[model samples]
Target: MLPRARPTRVVRMPDTSRLDGMTSTVTTPSSESVPRSHPADRTGAQVAADAAAVIGSADLSEAGLRRFLHGLPGVDRVGADGRAAHLGTRSIKTTAKAWALDLTISMVDLTTLEGADTPGKVRSLVAKARTPEPGDPTCPRPAAVCVYGDMVAEARDAVGNSGIRVAAVATAFPSGRAGRQVRLADTRDAVAAGADEIDMVIDRGAFLSGGFRKVYDDIVAVREVCHDAEHPAHLKVILETGELATYDNVRRASWLAMLAGADFIKTSTGKVSPAATLPVTVIMLEAVRDFLATTGVQVGVKPAGGIRTAKDAIKYLVSVNEVAGEPWLDPDYFRFGASSLLNDVLLQRQKLATGAYSGPDYVTID
Candidate 1:
């Protein structure tokens, strides 16, 4: 069993009185409780130095990484489940529901990563991303169009100045089984092809085997690739928490990725069972929250995979508000990596506007 941290109280429910008006009052941890280093404005090298400084080790050896990770606080499984279940039940009024529906649409990554993905299919997906509801101009476009690395140019061409980013999955996505050079090349190719963001999967096998330094080095290498790209694409590290086997591993992996300079720490690759759950997401949110409190560098959290409904998305929004605070409420700080979730959000948005639920055929088939 992993070492457990001192038990702390579960996160409190956020004040939601302003949700109906599209504003929220969330309570953040006081600066005195967690010292801030203001590392966000620093260069990558400075951020890396800051991470090393925080860990109290300049050399990130395997033993050093292991000691630091194990020495961190442990999670209370029962308390986490209870808090997640409690947050999921928060009621959303009509106006707030409408706002959430729109916000969910805008935060979607609008993905399609099948083995048989073609340019035409990617173009179609981009079309839906640009205008989810064709007739209604009020419909907000998705945050980005996510596709396989090879399809980055197609997605980029299709998105074309719509303000929607083009994210590509690289570093042997879904399974980080390739060699380091191959993974780096894969990332370079995607960025060269005009990808605005690169979603790289971590080596779950390495992590499970206690190769903490290997995992950290892998993310650092990928982060360097993203940083060196001509357009400087954002790097989202996919932890594939399903294979991690424990909440403790999830927290460690989250910190490892952030320390290695990942712009975002994602939950899964959407290729595994139990892809994204409230409890798991809550753990990740808490990691980012505490990380921000410590380093003053806010990292984004993306819970990909099984999220597929307007109500479910709203539940996640509530969790974001309550767990990580209001800073993560924007699309830049949070995202839903789903292909089918967009259609559901659109259906709910229509129902709110017309007072009647639209059929599945009303939206384009993703």
Candidate 2:
């Protein structure tokens, strides 16, 4: 006679909204709720790992993930914008201004994604990234050089050993309308080309159509492709906030990306009508702050596009300092995805060093 196997017991998580002042909610399984056999299902560990493979065992079902995002506290658009506007008014003067300018420069992901971007352009961009100001060795280089997937190898070769990384925008970048297989192939190509980081755009059509599962799965697929033993590419999920159209949607998208194993949640692709506004960036900062508080997992934030001047970049730094705290100030935790913004910061740095303001020709063209 054969012994019958015992059936495993599963229970639905209790409703968390009814709880008074619950800082953390469990719409999905809590750490203890997941089976011990599935180490990846452990909420605390998986959240901290922030790896795409871990997300496969995440306790949340498709419906649960949707509920969690929808149940998140709503954003007050006016209040958020007001706070950002007020933060913008804070002045950085003298030595403080000089320090802010340097910090801003260090955070820049100097980007060039044009179809016209050639090896020469990427090499020039790489030279600029390595030495923003050839005359002043004191001036630090920007964090990374961002390019299209096909240009990753060229960018990597040009910026070799300079400590400035090479980031490739993949997965049918800026549009994200390509099929899943094609998107995955695009990401793999970048990684195989030695891209240090991968910035992928989410399918906004799926998101807007309430295809949260599809979006999450897509991110997971890309994240998996980014992982390597010697050189794992950091994944930055771009939500394209302009197309999202609401602060609440931004917040939801931010959470969705974090849950799907995104190392960073980017604000925009910079191709759209409206890109990287203060209010939208504020919402993302809040999402990272709150997400960190609850999951003990910190994800970086990158506000791409529409940031053209040193003043605007400083304002963003200010918001980061006040909202996300000093820990997020590092390049590992924050980034500014800008092309022309780097020139402005460099010019300002020159102005601080010398008494005279530098012209456009003073800085590197790329």
Candidate 3:
């Protein structure tokens, strides 16, 4: 028999004064706090300038990126794991749980990236993204609907002006094995197809083989494609941390992507084992926090794969608050690249509202 649900602790909203240039706030449990819109887009040249400013007089050569990445503070694996485990134990009850459930739903990037994906499947995902809870008008929509480059147009048309973004994976995705020209074309196609955001996978092989400059150039190239687009899509650099093999490497990759002008640094492609572990995410959170402090540039973080339950999502929220501060709590700065996670969050949200669990049938099976 399943154990009865227990009350969880509330995550207190952090002070907004530390949010820097972020004008939007997410305080109350209401959906108003969920970010449904984004700030004006910047051009590719502007983004490059920002990256240059962060680089300062430092070397812009391959050796320079290598030196900088290797120079990042090494992550204490034991300490990170301990901190994440400790935070995971935090429990919230009633109102706080309700708020967290809503926030979790809002942060999701409902994704469907598969060989079997069809236009119909993408449309269903968009519908779910628009209204996660069928009858609850109060339910906040997800931050975005993530799909492949070819399906961007379908997603874009379906989403319309609902304020839900359409994010497409590009730069050859998953393996990122294509050449530079092919990868650039992939990004251009997605942007032209009206994707609001581009999630590009880094060359894990190049990164692991000490080809730091290659990886850096790959991200920079993709970022340029996003910014140069007429719509100026946001660029999310996926580090594929599961293959990165170490906590220290995760930190390096996070900083590397940020310095390369990644609007968001993602953890995985969801095609590998041990994807999106708390410790790896903690390292990433720390990297982004430190990057903001040093460069005055705020970047988002997305942990994809294996985060299916509302419980797991809440733990990540706690880590984001404790490590990166409250600024990241909003959907604008944090996202979950998940497909199954939304349905699970809906189930939990229903349970919290009605005091009774709704089985799997209550939510779509996408």
Candidate 3 lDDT by residue in tens digits, 1-366: 333222121112223233221211323222243322222244445444544445442335677667666765566676667777887989977898899989998999999999899999999999988878888999999999999999999999999999999999998888999999999999999999999999999999998888887888888788888887688899899999999998878877887788788889999999888889887887787776656555455789999999999899999998888777778898989999898888888998889888998999888787
- Per-candidate TM-scores read 0.90, 0.86, 0.87
Best-first order by TM-score: 1, 3, 2
Model 1 lDDT per residue over 275-319, tens place: 989888888888777677656677899999999988899999999
- How far residue 224's Cα lies from its native spot in candidate 2, in Å, is 0.9
lDDT of 1: 0.83
lDDT scores for all predictions? Answer: 0.83, 0.80, 0.80
Model 2 clash pairs are none
Alpha carbon lDDT at 59, candidate 2: 44
Winner of 1 and 3 under lDDT: 1
- The weakest ten consecutive residues by lDDT in model 2 span 18-27
lDDT string for model 2 (117-137, tens) is 999999999988888889989
Indicate which candidate wins on lDDT: 1
